[model samples]
Target: MDGFDETFDWVVVGSGAGSMTSALVMRQAGKSVLVLEKTGYVGGTTAKSGGVIWVPNNPLMRQAGEQDSTEAGIAYLEALAENLPGSTPEKRRAYVVESQKMIDFLLAQGIPLARGADFWPDYYDEVPGGCKTSRTVTARYFNKAELGPEWAARLRPGFVSQPAMLSEGLKLAWVGRSWKIKLLLLRIGLRVIAGKLTGKQWVSAGAALQGRLLKAVLDAGADVRIDSPVRELVIADGRVAGVIAESGGERRRIGARLGVLINAGGFAQNQAMRDRFMPGTRAEWSNTPEGDTGDMHAEMERIGAALGQMDQMVGYQMTRMPGWEQAFVKPPAQSLTGKPGAILVDQSGQRYMNEGGSYELYCQTMFERNRTVPAIPSWAIFDARFAQSYPIAGVRMAKMHQVWKDSGYLKEADTIEGLAAQIGVPAEALQATIARWNGFVDAGHDADFGRGARAYDQWLGDPFLKPNPALARIDQAPFYAVDVVPGDVSTYGGAVTDARARVLRPDGSVIDGLYACGVSSASVMGGVYVGAGASIGPSLAFGYVAARHAAGLDNSL
Candidate 1:
């Protein structure tokens, strides 16, 4: 590809983690870049995410005393995934191998970054070669002033209401434990005081991450257009050359001299796409932002770019009310049903899998069981004690919204049998299930599904609880049941890409000038939720890779 003056060297579609990184990288490499976003908001699904990035064997991991290896990461990917399109040995090696380069690139750009939570273990910590410590990093507390007033106002809020580091959030989650919580509060208080004295206003998590990238793009003089979506790709000489974007009832043809990269996210918001590809999931079942409607996916399909991973999503366990199912919310530590006195039961009122695994794993269980059982909209039963301990969603026990209760989102009763009756499940079966679960609780072990057996479960559990922190007898009065279902933090399926992040045709040849990353590309992790920030890590790496190659720079290292 030859560089053409008057046209941008690269045109990036979308404003998520991947697109922003691509724009930043190209602009930094002295290439003109343009970003087109479908919505008024810049951060696509990323703005709605918890912004820790998983990098295998990251420098921060080493500095934090975790001797993780790329080999171990490769092994973990291979062991966990099966028959995923891009999980080849070479690509997996590339993802692991490029972690440091990406980290170095962001650091060189002066992005504030530090080690994320050490307690944030890999999704499967018990498996062989699993990383038990922080291989993830987050943007350090960023002063919103870095984005200036207008841009700062547009940045999305963090996933959690708590604007603190992941480590601090983990410590602050120990609400029931007196001593540990007090100490954690004292540490946070000191940090807050120091910040006030310095007059540096700080924000953490996804907002900080996107703000840094957005700032880098803006500072590098990249052009960004909001409320603009690429509706069609202009293909010349069997290569993508430009895009026709529509805005305000008019269309404009924007030429790209280098390449067109579509990081416009997945079909999570499209019900037709979900039904055809990912079954049993509707638009209401995902945590993806409103703009991810798979419009670009449809546009690219017309150009013969091969796509896969439609059957997969980066699934999450979520609670949904009846009519408000489409607007799913991520579970805070308080809503995690694996906590003491809470249990998940299918329509038949029976436990299926361990309630206390990774959220994605929990979703996998629901999907697998739904093939034969009524597990899609499972019931999460908890005693009054559990509700009193933590907020369900954002509502405390006393604050359970009237609309939520009236709309059949929550079923409440003074006894488990009565609660089961209200929810239309078998009272006898639920009673038996509770009796069996209570036996396991009293015996200090889960004899049925091993709920509290794994380190991953205990990582989110209360340390001070006896027997098992994730288990408690549900013998208390005023039982409650909420409808929990499958949801996604992001979709893993998208356009297939090669080693260089170029979109591949059905016959496996590159589409010449087309590339993709983030949720728009088939996940490099093979749809396996490897660890915290897994999706963003590959997005950053391949976004960098796509830009470098499109600019005629060496990407073969």
Candidate 2:
């Protein structure tokens, strides 16, 4: 062991959005900070996510003339989170009161934001307090070159870049739509190609926001060390004073006189943890990297730090390539662009939820149903027309014939009974399920599970179709069945803390010099995600709050 003393005003563990946000806030306050990242690169799961920040009643919404009030937002979240046992009135109120301030703070830092995507709907639009107006906001496009060579190398590669450029946007849209979306997509394509030819790398949305924040942190002269996992938190006099970090095959203590913040993400990659905490899950993660091992959770628990929302996690049950654990599943859009082609079913051949529901709802439903039945390997059965029209997991079904066959993911047959036989289901049961589904499509109604039922569920459907794109009848021939396993973006449970972002002891007293944010702490949303970007939004907000508080600034915007 080598002995080295490197001191900073604040020491932050993890380089994810939350940790970086806190570090940047402190740096802006003219405080010297040291950030320790466990992975080889910066940007935790956030880099790989859809980076829209879902803050209701933000400045962008106001500018767009979308009527939103803090009270309404609060009410809506309260209603949505009411189902979860961990949700508390205090957390919900805190989220609403501080959300606008967090948005304003980011905007002040030269981060531009666009209006919430109007096309995307809130998860529960039918519920009261839901707003049709866009509240999600993202940064203006950023160029990777702006970060300089050294910083760019530290960022994770192969992550989604921004600006919704032509190439990527078109490909994403093509996942579930027909050629009718071509013109809207072609315009984006032209801009992307033009930017590339002109030596400009325009990034937008999550990528842009993350890039800007990273650049700002680096610009403020904060030192970031990659591949340095914090092994332990040194507590003295009931306060976190510093950390013992393992990096470069050596261990050393880095002390922070002011405070130590833990933002080291959730335990998505820890298969054992997932199996224990989140039962029946396949533990397939499409996260940024594989280094997130819940080191913070273990280290904090060892010191008697209280844990919150331990049973909940952000579930993303997508289809994946067999044996290739990291790939996410895409929706079924092949033959059903203009007609219904496939249906999602549990082992009992019964519909459980709308197939078009966001990954959160899908995973929740899977887990909920798995409690009583075998939902580990659900099936998405479709027809040959769907195979021809839309792509599965981003590849045209025809193109992936070899891969699917080799991987045992593709099950095909000329008749429904044959397909059921291959899928190990009762032939009569599956046929009956399909027959009932066809009736619902023909009558333009979904009585039984309400497929294409709600406005929210139909938001992502193909606009070219007369009825709901997500509600096509699966009556066509050459039936197909692809398996969907339980997956996730990250775990949601972790160390317990308050609105001020100070970590609390199990007895409810604040750990004076310790702060925690991101998935390293229980979510303020109380385990019910409202929309896209909810995970990282609170992560960044609380990080700012924690840093400001640690720097002795009043948490007043």
Candidate 3:
């Protein structure tokens, strides 16, 4: 052993939104805190994700003149998660109440958030209590130049490159006459080029957010140990006493007199765990640095922590580069929501669910369909015209055509039947499905699945198209299909915790001095995702709750 010993009042493991929030909360409460990260860099998957945090009825929403109530938000989630496990009344209440507290705390800490004014749309928008609001908040794009040399290098390069503001990659295919987004993109592009020309590095959204959080923690005199993986939780007399960590190939014991907060992410990268928990899932995750091995869950389980909602995991159907292991292809919003895009079909070439649904629902539907049929190698078919008009993810349609073909994704066919045949689907069934879809397009209404029928779905669809930009017939020729596999942003299930953000035993008592949040804890959303920022909202809230409760802040509840 190299002989390194450190102690703090609170120790937070994992540097995602949850861990940062917890650490910051504890710091604000006048507690000395230390954050231990396994990876060389801080910021977990959150630094790689869309930084928008969804908080219904938040100050930002109210300032934008959007009316939302806690009851309405709960109603919306309840309707979507209807029969799902973990959707308890207490959990729902805690999510809403704590969410506001998180927003207030962040704002007080100089974290500026712009309202995602037009981004509201629950997966099931037609359900009761679902409405459009600027509830989601995003940070202003900060240039990596502002973070200084030492701190910038400490960040994971790829992780900070996403939630690619209109600057990095446009989320909406077209700006729809929004000069703000256009200007932002232009500014970002110029800055990136300038930085490249000068041999300087650049970072955005998730990275920027992480940098801000880290700066706040450091400013508050908190210490962080990189490449230190917490191996075991030290429990004594039914309370977490400290942690055993491996740093620099040597074991070091760090005692946390107050608590140990575990935010070490979920098991998305763990194939064995994925296979065991989410059977039949192609558990490819585009997450933070790949070292996230679900250590928090494993440690908690060893200590007899009760696990909740192990069956749930966040899912995204990803478009990947054919031969590259690290490179990924982001699918265009138009490809999923626009009229030209065909319904996603499984390996057996059968229709699964509404292709215009949110990514979470899309994954859920794909998983369910895979159980009944071979949905692993599913395809997103579209016409040449749609490809030509809209940007598909980070790549243009023409570029995507080449990349998909080269990557063994795009399957060209002169007709739908030919395409179906190539994909190993019953040609007749695919033809019939297309015919029905065309009928809906012509009638300006989707009767079966109601694609583009709701305000939220429309938010993701083309706004210029009448009736619904998301609705269109697939009668055009030169049909094309690209394979899509179920991918994930991160895993959702981890150590189970209560409303107070306290880790719970199987018998439902708090594991004193221990707290878990973020992807390291069971999602408060249950199995249904609400919108873009749902993951981060609960993460921040629960982290705050955990820190507050741990610091003995009137833990009456």
Candidate 4:
């Protein structure tokens, strides 16, 4: 302790959900824990996301009578993972087994948990052992008052700041079609009104999730420091022992007797890193907060931690609108492009891939197509039917501003050929593509790419559609096009670690006393995103695993 300004049994860098979870685990073991966050906010990128956790055989799912097994979960992961780097058979098994335990622990601690919509399908539900009924879980709505005014103000806000649960938020897509959705809207309205009278600050999604975790950590007596950025991991006797961090406008050395865990997030905001690894992507297209600049990634690498899957990201396709950079939520094109009466086309006005699959695969295909075609800024062609029936980037089609057209964010024309001219694609090619799409709609089958063939694809489509939910004739007048870019919620690659969450060297040797989880560690799902909350699920699982190992306990089933 003499070599440090202060010391704790465990030091967690970053205030992401996983970091808070690890802190709770340490405190539950009666060990001292310190959480150092670089920003004034307590929650990291996890707070801004959907906050869904993908867990197979979770207690919430079992309570809801949803059936799942550890073997089936492992099979599902193994089917997709398939020897991909950063994911192993053992790691996959650990994720399936320990994630359930982690969720159980959180629930036992009184954290409000709920199962995601039963209709929500896994990204690759067609894969072996994949569940058509969702295995996702989310935190219920939490009032910020639970953390008191001081701590509540520091909780990071989500893109959807509305207090609606994630399930309620999904119902917005069926607004005019479903009677249940109408009822849900009425309920949401009343809730909003009640909040206006009660002075209660409610949050849902990622904000609710991290808020609950932060509360648990605080209640367990863990120390959390905001605006404290760890600059270096102090090594004593060739092992991570402490950290040199900036605290209260001064650099302070803080020691960790047990170990140091890095959950500090990925390098989504660092343009240089993006260019080096993901050459086609841009930092401007990222949805993560500016604090996710990959400082911990560089530090870990410098200290001999092997990095893997450096080019991967959680692709979340987004459409740019006026002032998109400043907007809390950029208009999402993931669902819109998959809906009836709309199809995505490259610069040459050619449809290349299935448009109604997972957003990750959609963006990956966009990049893959860009290798030979200019598809980075692809065109999403839609007709008046789609425009009138659905919302674009949360704005009703009738409410669209003339400024959007003037700024070229939304292009419109009375005919397909005219719309093609506006977007600088060949008129004939555009005409041919639309005709082919209309033919597919009539046939009730997408022979080209099978857009609506999967349950997951149809979930994103309009259920009211007859033949195929994801297919409709795009022959209506007043065609429109918008720029769809490969935006991301966060980078997916980072420091390589073993199944126990211990950082590993290139030669498979462990870095003693150093661990990583969340996006700071190489993803456990490999290159493919397995489900709705695959990112956060493994983060929580590995966090629990790391803490249990540090406590000299076994986490594996």
Best by TM-score: 4
Taking the tens digit of each residue's C-alpha lDDT, what string does model 2 give over 339-395? 246677788776676666556777788878878877767888888777776666556
Separately for all candidates shown, the number of backbone clashes (residues 3 or more apart, or on different chains) is 1, 12, 2, 0
Between candidates 1 and 3, name the one with more favorable lDDT.
1
Whole-model lDDT for model 4 versus the true structure?
0.89
* lDDT scores of the candidates, listed in order: 0.79, 0.73, 0.72, 0.89
Over 4 Å off in model 3, which ranges? 1-4, 82-87, 158-172, 175-202, 285-288, 328-340, 400-403, 554-556
Clash list (residue pairs), candidate 1:
284-326
Model 2, residue 374: C-alpha shift (Å) = 2.0
Q: Is candidate 1 or candidate 2 better by lDDT?
A: 1
TM-score of 1: 0.92
Q: Over the full model, what C-alpha lDDT does candidate 2 score relative to the true structure?
A: 0.73
TM-score of each: 0.92, 0.91, 0.91, 0.98
Q: lDDT per residue, candidate 3, 152-256, as tens digits?
A: 778655434522452235343455556765776676677767767886555566666677777777777788878898889887666788888898899988888
Candidate 4 regions with alpha-carbon error over 4 angstroms? 555-557
